[model samples]
Target: MHSKVLDRLLFKEDPVEKLQKETGKNVNDVHIDFNSGQTPQIPSQRYFQNSNIFINKHHRYSYMPAHTHDFIELNYMYSGHCRQYINDEPVALHAGNVILMDKDIVQKIDYVGESDILINILIKDDSILANVLNTLAQSTSLVTQFLVNASKVHAIHNNYILFDAQKNEVAQHLIDSLIIRGLGNDGSNAREVNLLLSLLLNELSHSIEAETHNFESGTDDLLQILQYIDQHFQTVSLAGIGRHFGYNSNYIGNKIKAETGFSFQSLVNRKRVSLAKQLLAETDYPIARIASEVGFSNASSLSKLFSKQIGYTPGVFRQRRHVLDVPRISRTLES
Candidate 1:
């Protein structure tokens, strides 16, 4: 199921058309149509599989409201002009420009123009790329290493991407050609594809430093504390966790609260709630036992908390989501 932004964008009145009407550009000649499609699940453990390229025409302001996908998405605006909000900030995108958005970011597109045509690619996040990243993180690819870690957040994550239409001929040609070659099941040499990937990162990093000067700013120490929180979601007190980086427990907890707007205990409870849902839908364990499995004190507490967060009791969520709540795996959908 999709969330609120998606529901609004797909069903509500056009926001961009209102803008055009205000500016008197809607002489009734422009036609605005919002389009959407569901992409089949792609196997990301290989090079790249089942990628799609779309070119759409929308005279009205067709918005992509904020939502996070479980994969990487890149956007290139080949023609027309637009302004977009990338992770709650206003970003101007135009012809010969591109945006590389990571999996964790929640963003929406906003633009006012005659026609907006863009190229978007969704990539699997934890596929073969994770393995490649683990290797890249430990070795001489220091810049890539920096980006690999940096790209894992809900913030405007990758600041090192800029596109200049008038300059950088090789990079421009490569971008255009990759869109063409990557669309089909043929004419793409592995060597060229690999080269394109490396060079794309290189040029993106180059431009990002110059144009996207307002990059992400925050505390790295706070981030590590958050990562520790994720690591020990089912844990408590955790004296050694803070000491691993020479931070005191109280100070670490305070930092997490300050940075992420959630107390340490609240974060842990949120994690437990998430895990509880997974267990309810994906396993056959009894409610009382599932509570202990995910570190809840008892079944009553789990039920009360899960209902508050999920808007349904564990039994109800299980029945609605899993339908059968079948004990064994069933292959219901075709690949």
Candidate 2:
């Protein structure tokens, strides 16, 4: 059923490149020979920069350094087993199980046996969602950000795909169907692709809930505040946002201060300043432009607020960022 995947990985640019000085022997030099029929097709996004997936039935490889992706990820094990070093947590998963990875998750995967049979789905916040929604909604919902709201999140929400067997079976089939449809649906209905994506999102939401903390804040009000902060990061004002949400401005402000250990304005201001710091370090744009780019109406506002929070001007903040890279506190404790 997934012969297409086999063809795409072999004789193609192997994103799973073997390291020069890895502990195991070099596997890159060995050429794959398929004299009987076509190898198979892999997901096109698999070869895209910063994204790839392979279903390794009996493949083996040397270790790669711990790395991270700027996109959500999912891994399902069909057979065999492997140990994963996910940030500070090390976990082992066998067949019929899976893991949902947050975008900033840093981890390394190591197969325990001859080869690991697994399928990976990598979703970067790109046209992938837009193409699926086929609408102008560009994922601006606050409820779905903290919690997965299937309607907004799913490409096809009203229906679902059927697996009727293993957990691995459904995810694998759905991704494979999408890959084929993406290649050339020709003019056929996209029902197959739509159902596949919706089902995949459902599966992933389950995985996320299972792995993450079962968080239930004493009051839903705190969550509402978080949503408000996320939604209006650019032009969010503590008083205005609080009033708009139907609470007295001071009451809302006090609630935020008590629950989160920060005043309402402080939380939203931190968000803007934090984003500004990122743009400053990553881009070569001028300070005035960077300030305006990060939602400050004027450069003076960014400078004043940045100094209050970070104790440095934007220029000096960027300069000290490289020098003052904070050592991972947990690493120190672990050592």
Candidate 3:
């Protein structure tokens, strides 16, 4: 039994379908002017307004070209089934399934019939997303951790997670609430929407049936390796991790590069640099000590890599961050 709101939104002949019926023109021939790139990049500004989140029904009866978007996208199979390709891999989604895609992933959708009701939920603002992730930081769910890592600006790869929520009543109900909140335009605040989204993700995180799909095989092993690196980056070694995972060092190294587009050492350095920045911003640790804590042999090594990665020395970064934080600290104290 569909909710009244879902029924109202699902069965309507949307304008795009109406235009296609009346003029016999496809959607691409109608109003969508894609970029001239080999894989057309869709800008978030095309769909986003003042809010960080936007929801819309997928236009039916058109062959969507292979394209990428600048924002995170989640597609919910509201009542029917559809098929799409992500990174040249075919994925079939049925009713009550959900697919969450990170930014810049190549995707294409097949033409759908009138019964297909796919809903698009675009997350346009990274800041808002970061806030949501922060609220879920304490979660130990692999899905939560994967999302946190994937959302980082320095993420090694773009990926997607598919949830089989067809029989999950909680997930379906939350999806309905999100659709209603997103489409009603009833003076609902962004915080409410964020909360609902947060709850939905948390629920999905706990769903044992949720499946993760990646562009390559051996993703489960890769995720395990990544998680191990994240936990022990300050002291992790390629040889040690290989031994731990029962693979040869050479094989592990090649697999890491093949799956993540980065070498094992590069991934470790990224993690160390990230921690170094945090220590510089929030603590009074000396540069040498911070370097040692983050796995650099000395301050000079950290400084060289920091300059290469961040365009400045650690001292300069710390001083700039302090200068930027003074006003905020003063306001906090006054309040």
Q: Which numbered prediction scores highest in lDDT against the true structure?
A: 3
Predicted candidate 2 versus true structure: per-residue lDDT over 1-335, tens digit per residue: 45656446432323343342255543433233323353322223433442222222223454333555544455655556677766647767665556655544566666433345555544444323222232112233221332222212222111111121244555556655655553323323233344455455554443332343223323345555565666666777767776778878888877666644556666667667756765665565667877776678788999999998767898896676546552211212111
TM-score of candidate 2 to 2 decimals: 0.40
- Residue range 18-113, candidate 1, lDDT tens digits: 666477543223222322442222233332443222222244544543444545666666566677665577777776676666544556666444
What pairs collide in candidate 1? 16-61, 160-208
Clash count per candidate: 2, 5, 0
Choose 1 or 3, whichever is better by TM-score: 3
List the candidate numbers ranked by TM-score, top first. 3, 1, 2
Candidate 1 lands at a TM-score of 0.45
> For model 1, how many clashes?
2
Q: Pick the candidate with the highest TM-score.
A: 3
For candidate 1, what is the lDDT? 0.52
**CA deviation > 4 Å runs, candidate 2:** 1-59, 112-114, 126-172, 175-195, 204-209, 213-335
Per-candidate RMSD, Å: 14.3, 16.8, 9.5
- Measured against the true structure, the TM-scores of the candidates, in listed sequence, are 0.45, 0.40, 0.60
Error of 1 at 263 (Å): 0.4
